[model samples]
Target chain A: MPPAHPPVDTADVFALLERGRALSTPVLRAAVGRLAPPMDTVAAYHFGWIDAEGRPADGDGGKAVRPALSLLSAEAAGSAPETGVPGAVAVELVHNFSLLHDDLMDGDEQRRHRDTVWKVHGPAQAILVGDALFALANEVLLEIGTVEAGRAARRLTTASRKLIDGQAQDISFEHRERVTVEECLEMEGNKTGALLACAVSIGAVLGGADDRTADILESYGHHLGLAFQAVDDLLGIWGDPEATGKQTWSDLRQRKKSLPVVAALAAGGPASEQLAELLAADAKSNDFDSFSEEEFATRAALIDEAGGREWTSQEARRQHTVAIEALSRVDMPEHVRAQLTALADFVVVRKR
Target chain B: MPPAHPPVDTADVFALLERGRALSTPVLRAAVGRLAPPMDTVAAYHFGWIDAEGRPADGDGGKAVRPALSLLSAEAAGSAPETGVPGAVAVELVHNFSLLHDDLMDGDEQRRHRDTVWKVHGPAQAILVGDALFALANEVLLEIGTVEAGRAARRLTTASRKLIDGQAQDISFEHRERVTVEECLEMEGNKTGALLACAVSIGAVLGGADDRTADILESYGHHLGLAFQAVDDLLGIWGDPEATGKQTWSDLRQRKKSLPVVAALAAGGPASEQLAELLAADAKSNDFDSFSEEEFATRAALIDEAGGREWTSQEARRQHTVAIEALSRVDMPEHVRAQLTALADFVVVRKR
Candidate 1:
């Protein structure tokens, strides 16, 4: 049978999610409102709820998934839903902050089928918007107060530092001609896994969970992030752009050092050599029109022949299995456990 | 006789300054220590305390001025010195965070006679270092755990938002061909004034100051910032590069829409028209080294004729007067008032 939409039931998650949204929206709005008019416009553009004129627009944003994960962990750890809500808002703000800045650094023009903040507002404005989001994220963390402050603040800071480390490594890899599989995994672990681990750990901490519970929750989140990133990598190469709304093999065009590419490089054979040639060519090609479709196909075949796809998929499944095992170690309600399992499965298996 | 250094007589402010530096150094080191081994190496270089290999180097960093201001305000507000130290450290972190990122955006190559962070560590690593600084700033704020989570967090968030708003305006002004005197003031008010204002306000808030005292301190800092920025603008055009270590009239070469430029632009006439031509020529001048000193002086003369220098100095004096008036409004020790006044004098009169 096909997986249910949203994977988990989301009843509990959404309840906390809505509360966070309600709490944060006004706070965000008030802060932005007080800013100079131009900065206020940039902030609105980042939220995707307003046009440059500050009027309401199509208003679709990414799924507040990370925040929900954080809130759910906090709830499952036995904290009141309200108790963990500030962190919910904070993690979401930080995630969006990263997205805004990352899009600029990567020169990504489109997100959610619309112009990125930088695309519409320009790069400088986008950078400031990201900065504002980052500042607000910290402010929200501070709001979580003293009892939860120690752990949550520490986790958030570490996560933020790791996120930048990951991005730095990712960008550095592009300039280099070679990379190892271990380097790629470590990069991904810092970039994607740091925040996920923080989300769950913060939730557990705020929920009054014991240290052991927090550790187990953190493990679950770490593996979940790895699996999620793997699925994202797969989609970058193989998923339908129309469904994912991402550029077609955008990573390939950019010669991104993703898992599959890194894996093929590590195999060290003729196929790997061919992959390298394609990468070198791609680096020089201003437009895809310069490369023949057959050349693209040949490169794809080389990656497959080197067992890059299979290796990546197997690693992803291994992470998912480990995540499930970690979740099992936590003593939560049966329904919550099932929900988390579903969420983990969905992360590893999703096409988009 | 030359004025006595206020640090000699201002025992409380001096002690707080020492304590602030002590608290900040450890926190900053601890946070940077957690960076990935490679990233840590780069961070060390960026902090001016180490070589590329993370070996200790001379002349490590600037005076912790922002933290000192914060700590002084906290003490003046009657908060226990220990309780307020964290807030002071947080502001310093935020200041350094801005400095690191600003160097990247401004394409600055040198700081304090050494290579700028980005010049040494590369842009990607430098960006991460800045992000780390920002994260640590938040961590410091979060360390002030108390039952008043909501209010405390709100204040921190508000201050951070102001900081970003100021930065946005600063970046935005760089690209503008024209800006008003009011707009320039407003921009600096956010960019420079806001953080200084927040430094005092955060200290006051943490030190258990009455809202009235916070308001007074905030006003004092705000006006003081205007004086400082105006003086900086004056120096940018007229000061000795040997003393400032900045290119003489470099702001003119860059066609910066600073306070003097804005004032000159506002005082439109034949002089202003000549100033505009100078700006146009600057825009086309590809090589700073190629321009003769005679031509640079001639162009600067046009700006001076347009009343740029005089108007800016007059405005600086006006702002300083307001700052002194605000200082009078604050009910503090006579010695503390004298110390703050001395600092204010230092800001307005500094050549570098």
Candidate 2:
């Protein structure tokens, strides 16, 4: 057995993410560099390695949480972190692929405090570049030329399918008259949980870990992803716009059937009825284009008063605890477990 | 050696395509069936298996050329056609994936004599279902659980990347003032040639054909695809709309920088100059929306007068010859060679 280091603090989670970036960035860049012209530039811009003009820029590439999970999972399987770099890069590519397409589908103009790919380039390139990245992810894994790599690729593709399914459901829900809390949870689980579950276990699979151990890690990640999404949902509604870089009561404005709204609607109280009526009216209002921030705030207040906020917060905490508890089923160094625990804590309780 | 059959005619080529469909459709349907909810229905609609209302309808699905090529390629490599089924299904999925996305990207309203996926479904489901099909393509290949499958998956992904790259160039060309014939040919090669080449050779690869044999088949496919696209470009401008299932002078109407247009522009004749001026005027024309059928016909006449139509026809013949010559480099049954040659003839000369 490997020697255990001291318990890791929350700061180590950032270090793990940084290390993931450091390790996976070079390979990721190399793989992306293989793309044909204009696509190479567009992908580079999307990754924040270059400005829209193709000039170098220091931009906020997302925190490499999935990659970090991959590397740490590999180490947790008693393998070198390098064994996981391919898995890390593959998952990261898949993540960005979803982001590029998602931003376009949702018609979001900004990501990471920068203009989204579709906004900067166009929707066509966004679709094409996203496709290229997904292809690259599969190429990267299969190029490893091992049976284990094939297995990992299958997991990645399965997660990708689930992610797409979730997006379809999410889009469908926008036109839906009502969505159950259970349906929302299932969608979120597929959208976010499946990918994270793959990220956390794929490296170990690549490292030749048995199915049982990988399953445990996958369970940990699935719950953590749900928790992470719950926190994001909270931020979408109640968190400060300054902290979240989103508009106040963003989910309320969009009428997203997110966890909080679905749960609140399912709660069946007078406040829930009020919240539902307000949302229905907002959705059908002739003055929808003229709906004021104050109106949106009123809707947010109704959702909050319906206990959506508290229920979501408690759900996040519950998922977080379950995620932490799952670590006990796997054999890993104490430091890795502590680090994974700390990351879950950060995800569940993050302000933004 | 297998028994050599009678020399096959054009009728046999359709039979080949039908046989491919017969073998691959079940597997393809099964893979698509695995998709969730609306995506399943959406994909079925796109595949012409079902109408927009989710009722079964015999809509015009594609001719299954890629799958046909795959099965023929495996047979040409001295393997059973069954050996190529996975490759066939994988390429068909990739082809449909590109179609689903490209229809949205190009904003085309109709395909295969019916509404495109994005026209019937929303753009969001189009994107999601396209992504899911692509993921499924990779999954299908990798699940074969062999080194050959892994190798085939790499080839598939590489071609997929090139396809995306080609699409990017195609979109970029729309905004540019000029696109050289060479540049246009390169884009078409990536957009149309890469995936076709993958389809034709991937089955051979999966059949464990040696690199040299696969390379020869790939060469044949590459040339055949170029020939096929040249014919398509010709049809885009000059063919019957009823036969081609497109608008009259479709390429000129969209200002698509297809082969004929680029070649005509580069010919530098008086007609070329006139054609160039008219196109520039059209691009700058605020009345582009009001451009009549007569104006479009005028552009088509100028392109024809400039020898664009003849050049494209000659290019198609040249490519067809090159493709048939490529078949002589590798030894297969005489009937197989004849069948392959017949398919090339059909593609180079098809109205659509």
Candidate 3:
């Protein structure tokens, strides 16, 4: 028999994000509003709700992808979206917390086309604000006053620890000569996958979903996170400068050891050998700025010729497929399933 | 009528600390063990469980005062001391997390007579390990899976936010010329009082105490924390370097705007004006290294002559009395209250 409601064709991805922002922004704002003084001001600036001078400025906050997943996961558990607001706000807070700290640690000057918090304020404010937001996430979750909230809080905290572990691994990789594809994946899984997976399942846990169902949703989100990263790595190297708001060959210029570079090196081709030597020499040099556009282009071309680009493309598709397959195991409403699937598709193919 | 269990005249402060260490160290170690490597290694080193080379070292950890309070709070709530191990472990983790980050932020080179984590490992590790421990603290609480655990988790996280806020205010105070005594006390309350209050009350919350009892205990902890900080500020300038394991005039050398200094500035006297000028000159100098013992001693003598030393000592005693009075509002074992009182007394009078 046909289902009462057939699955919608792919979800309208932008509409889904708008819906997420609408539902979660109020709760998110109220939570961030609880921060004290300059920390509060710095956080507001980081979120694009205000400018460095503390005046209200409508700037680019993030896409709210994690919040969307959290809200959808509540629907997927046969609960109302509002049931997921705490989890949604918590994941959003944690995501920004990481971003604030990572921007400082990586010495990034700009994000979302504006000066970062650390750049505008100082490194101390960045660290302090990040710590404040992280604490706020736990407070929001545990304040819900349910056993389910306790369970969800535990999940969120554990995932947060894994996220920290992943960041440490990424930082360590920066100084290394080589990182295996396996090690890179593991790091990305911890850094990005863990939080997304938690975001997907925490709402379900809060909505009283059983362990088995939450686990399946987590599996789906974990693969989607990998797919998301793969696409992000592709954009880092090959996306149009206008579209990405980055210089040509941005990752190459920065010597980021992302998926494509790691896979290319691991592939062991003539082009890979040349690419390795070029990279090693570039790394040893003190003045990377001395290199011209041709130098970065050459590195990018070598990486592509070594099958890095194609392998990453295929890996993204494979992970997307796995994510979809995992979603099929849960007995969610057909339309809700469609939204999650569409979100995964969007992540795998987004340009920025 | 005398209670069946007579109030002990006073607690042996060191013996109380040793008992706390015995009860909480195993749980603390186990919680930290869950952290991923390199992070785990860094945290172990920070806790003095291992040396910089990763060899086991029997080194000074800390006083275990927070853990003792946690354990004792459970007993005060009519629960076994074992009921509070999770709270004890969690607070210990939080205290160390603050220390790890503060050391990096303040550029302290040493702690507990050993090189700081950022000194031995790196700034990045110190930040990451601190974050990991903070996350672990929430995990330890929520994983207990009790209704009381949820309540306690909420309290701890709220306290943690205040602690971060306190740190931000403290950092900002560093760059300022003059800070009022009110502002200094508020910052100290947030930085030191909030966490101690959480430590003192969280176990009772977890042991199923009502909000009123917990609130009373928190008041006691808050005042005790202020008293403790006052003693610490005094020791920073006046204690022998061998006793504090710091240079003579340690806070002065760092240009810390601590309570005594603020109070002295607020006291309107000839000595206050002289001390302020010396501090202003010191602040403007690019070469603090050129300042001799005589210079620092002169500054200290001027501060003392301005009545800053006397004011701070009286403030500590006043706070200690308030802390003891708070205990009178809560119904608990007489011996437990006696121990808490004795702990507060020890803190106000401790030589180191």
Candidate 4:
């Protein structure tokens, strides 16, 4: 089949994301600032805007990718980007809320080259701040005072519920010795896809789009999220630490059951059998702290030899194509459509 | 001045609460049932409705006092109790969310004569379930689908944020050697008062009350919460473990800076000095696990001798009076006003 549309360039994606970030950052900060002190200070530090002492810092906040999607999705629904700021802020707050709590649950100490909130502050404060931000997200959506505010709140809540469910499943997965690829994908769909779908559809809802357009945007976001997670799984195993800001082979060292690892385990080849033996031996020894760098590298090579890496990469491309098809379902303005396509491409193709 | 109103009978209070619970319990269950398992199982266990094995069990969920207040407030605004079901459920869900997370943070193994969610499951599931419940609360409110739904969400969010803030402050207070009475009261107001006020006002808003009436109901709830917390502080120090489902003198054993303790520390009397010396010695010893029953008894006696017990009782009564006066500011039907009055009296006078 001939190409349905020209591929989106990386430069266009960055420029569009930069524009969305500029508009959404101030609104997000103001919403977070509405929380009382200590919590506000903790949230600021988590956002990479300030140090623990409340002084301005040089660290970067996250890419603001979710909010950018909200803004672009809003524009795609034929509304001004400003009209989507509330939805953008809501999604961003929820995203950070999950991040703060997830770090505590996983016992992670760092993120984006900064100490995690639970590390700088105590776990109790991190939990409370995550809650405050979650509540603040609902408050901001209601304050929008539009006719669609009620619907927006409902949508956000639905997404949040799924997000929590996904987290629960992910935590449970860590204890299980074997997990199917289907189960892993379902978990990712809830964990990542739900919020991203909310981010995409919320803008359309706020813009008063028809149900057909909103559904199409949500579909685009769901497939994009799956592709994003697949690519993230690949990066967890093989990407350069400098580009990803994560320790080399960090996932393998932690014995994480990522997509590729699970796929390799399920493949039933000789490499897969050997990989299982190695993992089982590691579990029995329980000496994760003394795991050498070479052992981590060997696990990565094993996953590749079992064809898990190739399968995951192919799955990412498949999902990316489906995401583009979903975007094509909605006849948005050419520029807006192109930006959405570019963002989806960036999600699957990014180095970080 | 003479008493502004007749004293409320406790029987009447329970009757009113029974009616509200009968009306609201089914709705609350249905809302919680919407969650996916094991979240549903965890929530059910947290609510004391079931065992960890998912079988029916004999356990009390709670007093259902907040839901009763919500329903009564709705009736005060000339609406049926059914109209307040959403608000009641929302309040109850948020209450459980706080309880689940607080139990994890405080490391309390028991609540309501049963294992806490964290103890029964684990901290990760407890945290995830709390997040799920919080989201469900918002979902319930938005599903009300009235013009007031937006306003209700905003009100609920505000109360939830303060509740989280109060929890954060309470955690921070545990590390401080001294906390002022003023700070203690402020924290109580945020922690307990905010949710009670929301419970009182949300019904009025749902019933389409004017701002004045809603504010009066909120004020009543605020004072009632303070009075309730004061009574709880007394119970923490002196109540029977059989009644409170907590260890005898639990707060003192943990060196909690509750309202009465803070007030005593600020009194500057000989008894205060003695109490301070005892507490300082305990801190220096740093042997909490081996703290004897005699030590706990002695600490309680010192606090009472310092006038903390008497002062707290007087403060509770004063707050009860203020709460009644706030209720008088609104003119509702005679029966509804009496129910509200009776509930307030029950709150202040309860032994548990």
The TM-score values for the models, in the order shown, are 0.82, 0.95, 0.95, 0.96
Q: Give the per-residue lDDT of model 4 (tens digit) for A1-352.
A: 1123465586888887888788998988898888877788999999988997889986778777888888887888889988888999999999999999998998877688777899899888888899998999988888777768677778888889889988887887877788899999999989998999889988878988877887788888889899888988998889888777778886776667889999999898899999999988877775777888998888889999998998898888888899889887788899888778788778877778
Sort order, lDDT high to low: 3, 2, 4, 1
Chain A TM-score for each candidate, in the given order? 0.87, 0.95, 0.95, 0.96
* DockQ, all candidates in order: 0.43, 0.76, 0.75, 0.75
The segments of candidate 2 whose C-alpha lies over 4 angstroms from its true place after superposition are: A1-8, B1-8
lDDT of 4 by residue, B25-111 (tens): 899899989888788888988887889788888687878889999998899999998878889999999999999999888888888
Q: In terms of DockQ, which candidate is stronger, 1 or 2?
A: 2
What would the per-residue lDDT of candidate 3 be over residues B89-111, giving only the tens digit for each residue? 99888888999988888888878
TM-score of candidate 1 on Cα atoms, chains taken together: 0.82
Report lDDT (CA) for all predictions: 0.72, 0.88, 0.88, 0.86
For model 3 chain A, where is the 10-residue window of minimal lDDT? A1-10
Model no. 1, DockQ: 0.43
With a 3 Å backbone cut-off (N, CA, C), the pairs that clash in candidate 2 are none
Q: Candidate 2, residues A1-352: lDDT per residue as tens digits?
A: 0102233366777788899989999999999999887889999999999998889988888867899999988999999999999999999999999999998998877677688999999898899999999999998998888888988988898899989989999988988879998899899999999999999999899999988998999999999999888888888888787677667777766779998899888888899999888878777877875788888778778778888888888888888878988999999999888788878877765677
- Give the runs in model 3 whose Cα sits over 4 Å from its true position: A1-11, B1-11
Off by over 4 Å in 4: A1-8, A52-54, B1-7
True contacts kept of each: 0.57, 0.85, 0.82, 0.74
